[model samples]
Target: MHWLRGMWAAARSGVRLQPHHLCAPRLVLRATAGLALAGFAGYWLFGLAAGVLAMFGGFMTGITTFQRSWRPDPVVPLVCALTMGATTFVGYLTSGSLPLFLTAAAVWTFLGGLCWSLGANSGPIALNNIVILLITVTLPNSFDHALGQAAFLTAGSLIQVVLVMFPPNERWQWHRTVLASALTAEADYARGLKDNNTVHFTPDSFLQAREADTLSPWQAAHQPAGLRGVRGPAEEIRPILASLADPAATGPDTDLSRRQARELLDTAATVLDAVAHAVRQGARVALPPDTAAALAHPQAATVPADPAPRAATHLRTLLHDLIEAANSPRPGRESTDPVRPPIPEQLRQAVRTLRGELRHDSPVLRHSLRSTVVVVAGYLIGHNLPLGHGYWVAMVAVLIMRPDFAQTYGRVASRFTGNLIGVTLASLTLALAHPNELVTGLLIIGCGGLVFLFMETGYAAVQAAGSTYCILGLGLAGESWSDAMPARFALTLLGGLLAMAAYALYPAWETSLLRERLAEWIEANLHYAAAVIHQYAEPAERTALRTRDAVVAARTARLAWEQALVRAADEPVRHRGLPPATAAAAGQAIKEAARITMLLEGNLPQSGTAPVPASSPLATALRQSAREAAESVRNNRAPTWEPVRQALADWNTPNPQEKALHHAGTLLSNALDDITTALDATALDTTAPDMQGTR
Candidate 1:
């Protein structure tokens, strides 16, 4: 027992248990209770068979579709109920014969599979219940007994859905606070870059901010629907953040708030830029007096008051860490100098940009379709072979493959290994005792509880092992062990092989798609960035854009990039769309942007007090170049580099503000170039095959 507890703790250590992680387990427990209760109530009201079926149906539904936004779709649940009822009616018509009941079960399972396959990928838990009920009905049993099980299941599933409809506690507040702080850090970083034209961006700072952003949305989704609903708030703030680079967008009370928030984010950015500079110089770079002052400023009032203290504390700590790391002398420290890393910042940013977009809504439907197709194909070819119950093996194959590549492999291997162990254990247990209902029930509950505890920790294998024991126990229901044990082992192996074949042949690759999606996100962020630049010219409107708002936009872009990276890493070969050169360029572009944000934040006090001339050549050129590059990326055209060259030329010239503008313009141009190349590459690849066929 002690060893098991130790093992369980070790397994759970890797999983970050946020507020949303609790939602699934709570739903599972409530649904289980509901099913049990429904069985008791319905048994007295409508007899045992009907009660059981209702409970099972309800239980299945609850597990499948309990999301934060879950609203009951009465049509599907009622239809599922009717389907189960009809199956029961047919079994009754057959007069309780074992063979007849089996036939009805098989037919219903096929029908259920077909119905589910149509939109199973998108449908709710009720559909899954239908699938489970179909299988349960087919088990060789009395007609009344099967019907009762289905009824109980259905009632339980319904109860779960109702309970889930009520929202959980607002736990997303901390996540939002973290995101808002990260954004402020970025703004501060950007401001600092504006103060020093020679500064380079640090990848580590961007990586940290990106990580925070990546986790934020998933955490938000897990929160109860009612509490901390800040998607709206974040969206509202996006435009303000985007307009930070524009000079016209700085004036008035509202504009001051945006400026303050941008300044705060820029402070963090400045720290990163300083680190990069220190790395380049091989010594600690002393912060400019103005930059140090900005970093020392009190927390921005624009951020939520509740989160402000934590945010300030975190920012201070992060800045201190960056300084310490920058100052540290170590081997290979020379390589930290900002001469472009192999991967481009733009591509990295694009990849990181997809966290918000990739939502997996239909794990089961995808599993079912992929499984069915693979199994059916295998059965058609292997049915006449030496393999007995080959079709059943193929069905098992479908269950093993999943979309999460790491998880799928882990589950398949675990399940196969655990089954081998479990089967041995179960056989030994049965040798000592005769299987009955009470023993079966106890095993089910014990296994189910273990599964609940370890579900997130590698549930597939645990469940598989449990199922192996349960099935073997069922096979012993009034039967001798010798006859059934051998057949059960053979069937299990057959199922595993079919699953393996399907997994190998029909693998779904998400890597390339993730890259493409991330590229689109980069374009969107660029659009927002361009808008921010334009807004700077309209100072009156800048006040309307809060610092919180700008932070949200930057955070959104960072989140997308993080998600894209995860997906790409999952299947790197499949999604390797950006050429090495292009990827490097993109990465550099993001680094430059981060540095620019830092400089801008750090220099706000110096630059903000005096309004630049409207006709300033540097400002006009920066605005024009950024806008054009943004448009070029959107239009899928090659970005013009001439504006960037001109900006760089000015950056090297004498004017201070002009130099700042020039540096920003150059960075924007580089980002645009990377985006344009990626988009063009995508378009060419997508069309090339079609063009070749035409030829």
Candidate 2:
């Protein structure tokens, strides 16, 4: 009964048609027109099969281009085109024998599923390869014919590559957009802190912008001066914003100081927003007159005293630098330095990352196994069925299944309904009108356009258009509309069912992993906090690097936990070992600890300055307590921070000059106490009868 309910709920959620940002019209129109042209020309010159093959090649390549990947835009189209072309040729070669084809298909399907381990971009490309291969095998041919089809497919894809390579005249558009997003996020955070000091802020945009800043050799040599070093100041501003808004460090808002701080924070928000807008639009900064005056010359009296004023001044300076960077002219000359790792090194790193996922516990490995089984099973059943078009069953399964329950189930529901609507409508149209080749060709192009237009709107809409396009394209070929319609409808239904069943049998429920995710986040935060304290204890070049690495790891772990929480939310599983209330409390406590740690990091002493040796004991205690807390979390026991408290007690009367370190230590101890309290509640919750068993 629970499983049935889960399917119903997932189906409901999946079919929702939410509003989403539209893709660029130019990009959509270009790909659609190119596909239409190729299909029509092929049909006019040669035959319907050749036209359909050409359209398939173009559609596959264009879809890859439409995906949101961190890889260079041009690179994706070219790589995917070549990869799909090769897969098509291979599929044709193996199609002579069912056994050979199934074995090869199983291997290909597993590798395609494993491609997710590489990255989001690689996953889609691999899926496209699988799709082309499946479609290719349905039409077995001789070697020469296979080569001709491969060439036609490559030519179709290369056309899209050309279109992408010479897109609209907006060099560095992606970098500018990401950087602008980061600044806008910071601006929103600043404004949010006015009402609530502890508003949640994520550095995801900043991380993306940082990654975008890593330029290729040609980009580095000719990039604008503004883009090169602006992110440093932008990142520096985040910690300062966190520090200024922290009531623990700055005191309550019941006084003049707090009011002044809020006013300055609002001013900073205004400036940051303006800078972000200018950066995104690629225009000169247009600050308000008063904000401009303030940035030009910050007044001492206008800002609060007690580091707030200095922090406000620093904010002003950073804002000024950002504005300048936004408006700075491009470099007149190019450098000869390489900015990215070599191709061989990158391939080696990719291989190492994939190797790390070979473990039994790895989600990629499990997904690959499931994918291999389901695809091969679907193939065997589809082939044995009296109804033809066997590949449709496996294709439907491949299109719907994903790494997580939420996506897999949601897509299964959406894709099935969509295929039903599409097949019925296209079949009705064909039966009613009996359009000629020209009208059919135009209908195919129109459906293709709809697919691109609704790419992000929702899967249901895309699938609806895609299914219609598939029916029309195949109908334009030699297939009878009546025959294609029922086969497609039944096979699609079978594939979605198979996908759902496979996932149920081998589920990777995020609920089961929440405890480990929470533990990882807690451990990372502790390490980050200890690293900040160590900077106070013994400042050095290597110590700074260590601190940076620790913070990065902490952010990564935090992001992973947040993602898992979201994925697990809609999963209809009761009795999650870690209760929601306990998870929320633990998350809040860890975030507070991380914020306090960032505050300490913001006030780190300058290099070559005298170190606060008194903090050495506290740092060591933090490291020891971190390991203990992680183990306790895994065991569903309360974590103790007695050692941290003791270390703080021992440093109770530190030197006056080390007051910052002393105060930060006190806050850390309190945060650790909160974590302990949260974990105690967790211990109590997990032991309850209601939470004793997993779904």
Candidate 3:
């Protein structure tokens, strides 16, 4: 019954999807144009072979890598065609023998997968060629054939570049789209707080926020970059929004103080709605005088007064920051972007990353090996079977298989089932009548549009549209319609089974890395807490930087741990290290520790008259706790409570700052102790291995 419920839930999840937005048309149209032109022209000008290369090399490459990266240069589609062309040529050269192909694929894929640490687009750079290689292995080998393949590959991508150079007709562009989404989300989030409901922000929201800040307008790379007006406000309100959207899902629920907090949240929501609309309508937002006057009063500014953070104060900061960003950004703040790493430095970093991972029991290395084995198996079996288009078996395996077992397993049902629905739809369209240039062109466009539209929706819809396009594309390239569907169906099923089998037999679990992540998280939060404590010793102008660094580091470690936990749950292997409950408790410990650090940092003066010392006793206790926490997490030892009483003897409660520090310290100390208790019960091998840089 439990297994049935899980399956049913997975099926339901496949249907619910995120909606597509219009502000960022991006390079989709251009890529689609390139695809259509190449697919149409190649078949007529050259042959089916030329068409096949164009389809894979041109359109697929352009569209897959169309999204902009962090560096704001004129975003040219650089990776796809190059990767596709190389894979195609390589596959052709190695196809002379199955053994040769397998050896080449294993090595090539390993190197490519190593680049994944580089960035988001790097993953495609890793997998795209392998995907094309799967098809390439079936083609006959010859030098002239490889050259011709290379020439058409170049032509396909060049066409996309040319079309992308053309002007667009949209107003509120990418920045507007991102800003609107963020503002809308925050507005909704504020309302959720006011109504006492759970509010969660998905990862998509983060991507949109990042783009609004980083992306440049098309071709006009020198035209001052993305939404300069909202940059300060975007940075300011992002964390507050995160707090509101925290998955912990506490809602100031019905206490007297919370009732007071709700009224302020409602006002904040109204302000957010106005700001949201102003940004949407391309007008500046105004700071509401009523709220501003309330905050301006010293009495209201020092909120909660109960040691715990005041949501009202947080809301005020959020609203004021939004107003300043919308109406009065500091001079020169909008004039520049943060210094990004130079190309040389970035390359150096990538090389260093690759070198570092080479020695470890890295998942990417293992995943690459798994992917290679499965692809080779599929490739060999398909050839042996009496099936046409045997390459799809390998291609599908490459597409579906991932580094982690659970993720790979989850995709099996979705991909196989999605392929069935998608191919059936396309097959039915063709069965109605043979599609000429016009019919085929419309079908391709519709399918491409849906694929991008539903890309984030989930795997099933994406596969459906993706498979439909592939089948239609193959048909246009001269494959008999009768052969295409059966091949796709049979090959996809075989591929799915192969992927599931590969994972089940010798599945890799992310749990092995959990301790490292936990250690990292503890270290990051400790750094953050120490920075906040040090502020009490001597208030510094640059304290915020330390806090910001801490936030970033903690967020990184937390994300890795969360991903590991999810993967661990689905992973067949368990009892390797911290058991499930202990691991979860450890996660909660770190989360709360991070929150306390954030609160401490928030309470620190940006720059001001030194108040009574907030350090000592409580501050000293927290600093000590942080050190102990990091050491405990790294060494797998239960942290001993070593509370120093010297500072407490000198402490005075009349100082509000000291009181607040005391409160935050108490929380951090409790979290550290919780982590100690959680790990204390573990009975793993105590002899720690020689690991890489512990810090």
Candidate 4:
């Protein structure tokens, strides 16, 4: 009954989309188009074997290069194709006996599924090989056949290698674009703060910005030889970014000088825009003189009352680092040497990653077990039922199952819908038109092109195009899958059902995990905020890398909460968590306070300037708020932060630096208050029973 509702809810809704996500995945269209063109040409020239080679090459080309920058010889593509070819030989050699065939297929599915823990894009290769094993078994069992298949695959690989040597302008765009994007998001958040009327810092924009930033470092590493050392993550100069990102990202706008702070934030945005532009063009970053002046003059010692552009001033040093990196060239950083670690280390890491997930409470381990069951169940049903096109059952199963309920259920609905439409059309086509080499070739080309283009835009569309291409491509090999169209569609639906049902085999929902996830998020933010507060109170000589890691960790925990919450939304009445919006406000506020602390890190004691005494109001208030926030966050209770609040209100000593420090304390107090209020609202709401006292 629960599973039925999950399917209905998933099928009724459309896939949730993100903003500006169509940047890189569209490049995949070219590879698919190449597959359609080259695969059929090979079919026409050499035979069915050559066509399969060309088609598989193109398919793997898109999959292998999924996350990498534009470069020749992407590691995963080559590994996948070779694995496919090798496994093809082994599976074919065992095809004569039922026992041997079952053994080979089991090994293929299990071993391939295991590759998932290796890294992103690794699991698909594993699953692809299992499909290849199924596809190969349908052919004659002979070594001579395997050799013919292997030879054509090499030719197809050569074509893909040549094609990737030159790619579109957007190939490495996300890497550099995200560097600028993170800054731009920061700029927007800062500007929001400058308006002085906004309460929330807008968590989604900042979260998206941070996620983008996280992907930049690795992408930049693979951008061919010349574009190598482009400075890692926005954090390289995070101290400056922290301040610039800090004041703008957090605090009480009413507490500070409105006009001056707005100018400071607007100026910082302008500076970042220029930096973003330079990053895109691979040119040196240059800040405008007015912005430079902001950084150079933190304050006039004579007039202690004027607030300085502290973040912008600190940001000047960050600009210099980016400029220096942009102008310099580092050679061969992404080595041509094979990218895999030594076999021993690779095995060790893969085992460690998998073992860690196999705990009694591990979601990933449970998901993996569920996947294994789905694969085995689909195979057993197909084999026993005498379905001629049985591979389609497991093929859809592999494609649809996901690590979580929302995604798996969503893919089940989408894949089943797509396959239904596609297989029906292909059936009509095969029934109406003559089955010849030329017609098959044309269908493959058309469907392949559509598959890649729609991949990121619409899941159902991709499935429709992909299923057509697969059916038509296999028809060229005399598989006659389209002849069994009704059966194939039924099996595809079965695959999807099994995928959906698999999640129930090991139930783990956000409702069950909410307490731990929230606890982890709070703990991470607590450490991050503490590091930031202390830095502001006592300016650091150097950036603390540990503090930066803590920020990253907090962001990670926050993301986990977001993803789990999404899954919880699809769950039953008894299995859901507190709403994301409330949690997000508290979470984002914590990040804002931390970011301000980071920005203030570069406020080193200037040579002639004397440090403020430890007993000063701002200093003492910061210490008190930091202490109170720790307890409040730990217990999910409203803090009696009257000391910090009083300290902020009474610190009428006209000093710009002191005012900024006071604002940081206010941000801390408000953030704690927000956390407490959110928890209270959740506890008071009787509609959801997911959390325990909302703690």
Best by lDDT: 2
lDDT (tens digit, per residue) of candidate 3 on 18-111: 5554314454565566677876677789976786566556656555544544432123355566667777788788878768878887777677
For model 3, where is the 10-residue window of minimal lDDT?
244-253
Q: What is candidate 2's local distance difference test score? A: 0.79
Worst 10 residues of 4 by lDDT: 300-309
Q: lDDT tens digits, residues 1-695, model 1?
A: 53244323423432223323333555456545544555456556876455444544554443343322211233344444455445444545553554453354444433333333333333333234334532453443665555555445545546644554444422233333343443344445356434443344323333343333332234434533222221222222222233333332222324554445456556555554554444333456478776677656645323333223333344454455445444443311112111222337634643443332233333233344555565455444444555443344443444544544444444555555656666666666667765564465445444444444344444444555455544544443444455445655676566655665554454444443444444444544444444344333333335224322443454565555555555345432423344345544564565445434433332232123444332144444544654565555434344555654564565443555534544555565666566555456544544322111111
* Model 4 stretches with alpha carbons more than 4 Å out: 1-6, 13-33, 36-46, 66-73, 93-119, 150-158, 167-171, 197-257, 281-312, 316-348, 479-482, 533-543, 573-670, 673-695
Model 1 misplaced regions, further than 4 Å: 1-32, 35-134, 137-150, 159-369, 378-395, 404-407, 464-469, 472-489, 511-515, 539-564, 567-585, 594-663, 670-695
Candidate number that wins on TM-score, 2 or 4: 2
Q: Whose TM-score is greatest here?
A: 2
Q: How accurate is candidate 3 locally (lDDT)?
A: 0.62
lDDT ranking, high to low: 2, 3, 4, 1
TM-score (C-alpha, index-matched) for candidate 4: 0.77
As a whole number from 0 to 100, the lDDT of residue 245 in candidate 4 is 29
User: What value does the lDDT take at residue 532 in candidate 4?
Assistant: 51
TM-score of each: 0.54, 0.94, 0.79, 0.77
Q: What is the per-residue lDDT of model 2 for residues 461-537, given as tens digits with 9 covering 90 to 100?
A: 88998999988877887678899988887898899989988887887777777778888998888889888898887
- Cα deviation of 474, candidate 3, in Å: 3.2
Model 1 accuracy (lDDT, Cα): 0.44
